[model samples]
Target: MLVQDAKNLVIERGGVLNCLGPKLGARFDYDADLRPLFPLIKGNLANAQLYDRPERVQFLLDGILCTIYAQEVVAAPFLERDQVLRFIHRLTATLNDLYTRRHSLGRNHRKTTMLPVYDIYRLLPGTNCTACGQPSCLAFAAALSRGRSYPDRCPGFRQPIAHHAVYPVYDQNGNLVSTLEMELAADADELNRQAQPTREHPAVALLTAREEEVLRLLAKGASNPEIAVALAISPHTVKTHVGHLFDKLGVNDRTQAAVWAHTHHYL
Candidate 1:
């Protein structure tokens, strides 16, 4: 099966993709054949938001498959042709990073069933004491909901409700995804970690809005001409913006710019 082949390739390349339980979070399982031939649900979700072109998505999937196949075929120990494989791997990583970033920023994936902090606090004993460190239980609960505070900070909730509170995530069909079996606090901790604020690079602020949009496309592994076509701009304009981004970010090449942008949340 193509999915099996993809799995094998990943394993052969010293990578592991495991199906984590609901407590950990929903895992993205790719069917190797389906990945190239069919559109991913996440890609569909992104298309709905105009974050990616369908053709580009297909191309990225195809490139990923090709890279995997190349890795499987070039199983030699010698350095016969290292540069080509390294370039492919870098491109694959950039495409994957862009897909993840688009999914993360999509409004459709936002927590829809999050319980209001006030409601959770109302269930608590209405003590205005600073035991929780925010002057009131409501403040503490709000911070917890925002991922700015942990449940353990609330002295009252630590023992009683910490084990029952649940975070929400939607499956591909818009249904609630079942979390893996785990204690509630453990699940909450995992959720909180995922919700931490991303850090943006200082150089990102130097980009014009148009340049930023182009950069996002580039980070998604779009070629300069492809980006120009998507944005209805000339290829020359795309190259100009690319050059500006490289200068501002102090990078010498597209791959490095992409890596820095992804690492700093600029993409």
Candidate 2:
């Protein structure tokens, strides 16, 4: 599969740009009918929204909207785009290939229900307490929904408040002033809209197809003989493949090689 056609690398409006860094937009090319990419993508991304009928998977990468369509892929920060592309390629290798990692996306691979302020207001204690510096709980809910304030600011929520988090709210000094940062789904997006590019990941590009297969098998705790049997190859060939993977991953042992694969998102 010719996974993607990277049309052009655009440097976003405001910042120092890296070689592979604001965004890469591409018309994805693949036999879409055979692969379960939407489910796989919805499974891998941490923040994702999926539409079942239209077949769209939307997610946020470093605060950028990574909208994936049946025929296209758009993501910001060169490294992120590269990562998504590689992930797609790895998954598309076989119909059964699926990503096994931290997935935080759709609730049911369905459309996102609009969450209005009224719905949030109903969840509040309705105490009308000024303990959070707000005039009332409704006002606090409003602010909380916008992510302008956090739930911990309210003394009423000493216990958990269903789905809300008491994340750290950093001050201008980059010091933790309070653990009162609440993310109400949509409002928890990154504070900085102008995303900065991440460091390059050149390790993935160094591995060959056979090495990748060997790495995947190693990640599954397979031995050389197991891998040989799985790939329909001899144990000696499997050893050679494993050696090449180790050299590329800069790891001496199979365990280290597996760790490298996982850390690099290759597995």
Candidate 1 local distance difference test against the native: 0.43
Candidate 1's residue-wise lDDT over 1-267, tens digit each?
Answer: 222212222122111112111111111223433333123333443221111211212122222222112122212111223433454455445445545554454333222122345445544456767565454565455444434455555555524412455433334465654322113435666655534443433333345566667778887899999998998878987888788676545455676566445544555
Question: What are the runs in model 2 whose C-alpha is more than 4 Å off?
Answer: 1-36, 44-47, 51-55, 59-65, 79-96, 99-112, 122-267
Q: What stretches of model 1 exceed 4 Å from their correct place?
A: 1-200
lDDT for 200 in candidate 2 is: 25
lDDT of 2 by residue, 115-170 (tens): 23444454466788677655566555554543445555666654442345644434
* TM-score of every model versus the real structure: 0.27, 0.31
Positional deviation of residue 100's Cα in model 1 after best superposition, in angstroms: 52
